[model samples]
Target: MQETSVTKRFNELFDKLEHCDEDEQRQKIEEMNEMINEMDEEEFEYVFTTELFNKIHEMIEDKKISLENAILLLKYIGYYKVLKGIRINGFNESSLEEKFKEIIYDENEKKDEDKNEIIFVDICECYFMLNNQFSSDMYPICAPCLLNVASSKEKKEEAQKKVEVALLALSNSSTVNV
Candidate 1:
């Protein structure tokens, strides 16, 4: 049987993600984000189905991909879902939150000065994009993680961007009435 366009594109993206180095993974992620952004609402909803989210989530949980890349992929998906006004149907919000919390609360991951800054930035963006879906009660669990990233002095050049994303997550979380 021939592969469908969605399947083909998803496989291509995932293949690149699995095989690439850190910089190449980032490039592929950016490309994937652009492709998602260009999709119309119906198309986006169709392509990014519950099964797709589950597959990606499983990859993250199984440690098949780096946390940073997984979060970046989730961030873009959340952003496009919000932008397109698409209602999440079969996506598992609880599992996603659990994964986010695990990554955020992992002290060892934060202790890595070389990678923690970008990881936290991506986490904040993920939270911001999915703010409406997450409860305000979850904010406390995430705020301290963001604070740690914001205060890190090793990456002075990227500090502002990190701080901005952290603030964005906090602001969105605070304002969520749901």
Candidate 2:
């Protein structure tokens, strides 16, 4: 079956990620990221569907796309949803939150120094925005990883600084709203 034009456009975008070399991958992903802002609201239903997300997840599982790029795609896709005030129809909120927990709160993943601390930070930012400015956990899921980022005082100085502020806000606000 022939896909709709919107699906095809986004598939092309994902394909760019799939096909590019390491040098060109970031640029292509950025290209797709920027294009998301330019897309009309009419296209969002197609763009943000569960099937689309499943495709991205499969791509990640298959090693067809890097986790960084997939997360970047999700972050911008999520921002566009929030900024446009459109909630995805039939999307399971818990499933997404669970996935977020797996990404952020994994103890085994946390022990690796090579793991991207910035992804933890970015996930926290994205969670707040997508959850209507609410933190998912009272203590926050990424707090352990981010706390280390702060306490170690290493290369991620900016990440460390952001973590401090986020933890403060997370602790203060999560109890009040929901």
Candidate 3:
């Protein structure tokens, strides 16, 4: 199969993201966000495959990319997946689950309340978007962080939004019961 223009553009953007410094990476991410927003469901889904997701996930795990940037990329993808009603394939859910656990359980992140809350909300939203593919174990690992965000008083509106997403995730996970 031949590569589409969208694939070429996305790859170019991702390559820039990989090679750029933090400032450049942020700029590249913004550009990528724009590109994604312009794509329809089929166009967007065609650009992302399981192998591509694994490569991005590896970048996050290897510390080659900042967690915030990585999560930003993922949240965009996850949001589109939900919006398009598409399912992800070929990605290893177990590996993602473990990484999410590490992020949620990290003491350093926990110490920074604002950052921690943002991470938790992004992650919960991602999980909610990918609800069909998640393992039962995901609920247990994510529940504590979600609960923390739900009870947080500092960012009431955002917290409430996250809480609703968390509840949706938990509600979906209950049907899996695996």
Candidate 4:
């Protein structure tokens, strides 16, 4: 038979526990606590043995409860398979941030090379030097640092645009020697 997902099972378990009276909840917590105490992290993760599954199935059968409540009750037992789904299954958040930085750097390097623009201090570097913080290291800038750098960059761009427009207007107004 196809195995039900941990998340689906956990949701069912949560619902059942929520519905139970205090006495039932206390009993349920004790059962769950026992199950948790028996397993370490690795065992908890991969040791979803048939015995546990059968015990859950039996609980549903004995309770004559709806499938939802059974799931919830099992969830209350706290040994439900749903925990596997909630785990941080892949790369760490910091690794993801580093990957993002790589993409941004690749794009920026290409743009810089094409434009023949030698920026002595890129925004990342400027933010770091001025604030004594590493901004590009995993979008590592704090909120205040990001805001300050963003506003400064915006102001610089606006000034450059005004200069370019002024130069263009001056050339248009003046007669060329040609």
**Predicted structure with the largest TM-score when compared to the true one:** 3
Per-residue CA lDDT of candidate 3, range 1-178, in tens? Answer: 3566766787888976777777788788777877877776667657666666667777777766787887777767766666566666533443564566566556324556555566676676566555455566556666665566556566577656666655554544443446
Please identify which of the two predictions, 1 or 2, would achieve the higher TM-score against the true structure.
1
Better of 1 and 4 by lDDT: 1
- Give candidate 1's total backbone clashes: 0
Candidate 3 backbone clash number: 0
lDDT of 4 by residue, 1-178 (tens): 2323443343344346545765675565455445544544454444333344444444445663433433333332222222322221221222322332454455445644563121211322221211212343424222232333334434577655433422322222122222
Worst 10 residues of 4 by lDDT: 124-133
| Candidate 3 global CA lDDT score | 0.64
Per-candidate clash tally: 0, 0, 0, 6
- Please report the candidate that would top lDDT against the real structure: 3
Please give the distance, in angstroms, between residue 57's alpha carbon in candidate 1 and its true position after superposition: 2.7
Candidate ranking under TM-score, highest first, comes to: 3, 1, 2, 4
The segments of candidate 3 whose C-alpha lies over 4 angstroms from its true place after superposition are: 90-98, 105-115, 147-177
TM-scores across all candidates? 0.63, 0.62, 0.71, 0.23
* Candidates by lDDT, descending order: 3, 1, 2, 4
Off by over 4 Å in 1: 1-11, 19-23, 83-85, 89-94, 107-118, 143-178
Q: Per-residue alpha-carbon lDDT of model 1 for 146-169, expressed as tens digits? A: 676656666565677666555555
The true-versus-predicted C-alpha distance at residue 146 of model 4, in Å, is 35
Which model is ahead, 2 or 4, in terms of lDDT? 2
